[model samples]
Target: PEQAEVREIPAYIIRLQDEDIVAYSRVCPKGCRYLNYIPEPRKCSHCNTQRGRDLCCCGFAVDNPVLKCPKCWSIFDLARKGQILCGRAPRPPVEFKLDLDGESIVIASLQERIW
Candidate 1:
């Protein structure tokens, strides 16, 4: 069978093991891609750092439950509405309200002011 083409979505959806769904913007607040690679424990492909560097994206781990920006090393909590755990980002990533309709998830509205 032929493989289906993979297209990039405008946002990121994180489904926890408990069936809870959370969504956030793909664009990082620091003007970089939020998650350009498969998130690993304390590993960021963009920063290419193995050591514990605060200025690198090597802290966005699923076990740690945070999303780290590769450019500025901003940390965002995945459980607490993408709250800023730490770093230089002036604001958190824009979150989108989602509604499940039958088999599809719809973007209801923006949770934060864009402007």
Candidate 2:
């Protein structure tokens, strides 16, 4: 999914593999750079293991990429607890719980802390 905003904050709404829907702050805490939604066959997942076709640094040529950290080469796999896979970030992504309205997802409150 592309970057969308919640209450003007950069965020993304992701539908997990299990069909569960959730939201996360797309802003990287390391430098506040927007995280790229890079799918698998990724360039890399961390600093030491380079397994994918391209390095996580390459922001080009990726189709449906997972959330990747361009500044510190960190990658986030949505299937997990949305942890900071690598790099210098001290915490995981901030999660925002969504509510199901009449055929819509709604954000009804403001959260100032990281989940």
Candidate 3:
């Protein structure tokens, strides 16, 4: 029997090439409940409804490394501590320190680098 290696955490998880786990807040800081995830380059569905502009939240994994906001088009880099690549986000998303115990993952502390 094959055991499930992937477990869902409360936050948005990104598994790196080195098997390192990085987590971020799923909620966009720009006052939107739209959950961010790894997706191909395309126009955001939510933003598209409001405006006729094609906005991209394209960034996930090692290949594409920026998570753009669907609402304001704010871009955040996943590689460099989730720093703001561009756009008006006030600050980067909140990153949490994770710890693995057996098959369970726990959030140790909240990284408050961003306001």
Clashing pairs for model 2 are 37-65, 38-65, 38-66, 39-64, 39-65, 39-66, 43-54
lDDT of 3 by residue, 1-115 (tens): 0244555554666765556777787666776654456443343354455343434444223354456666676777666777776567777788888887777766778886724
Candidate 3 overall lDDT versus native: 0.62
Error of 2 at 48 (Å): 16
lDDT of 2 by residue, 55-101 (tens): 54433333333576667766555666565555677665666777877
Point out the worst 10-residue segment of candidate 3 by lDDT: 52-61
Q: Report the Cα lDDT for residue 67, model 2.
A: 73
Q: Give per-residue CA lDDT, model 1, range 47-83, as digits (tens).
A: 5643545356444445545666767667777677777
The best candidate in terms of lDDT: 1
**What does the lDDT come to for candidate 1?**
0.65
* Superposition-based RMSD of candidate 3 using all C-alpha atoms, in angstroms: 5.0
Please identify model 3 stretches exceeding 4 Å from their true place. Answer: 1-10, 39-54, 57-62
Query: What local distance difference test score does each model get?
Result: 0.65, 0.60, 0.62
Model 3, backbone clash pairs (residues 3+ apart or across chains), number: 0
Backbone clash count, each prediction separately = 0, 7, 0
Is 2 or 3 the stronger prediction by lDDT? 3
Ranking by lDDT: 1, 3, 2
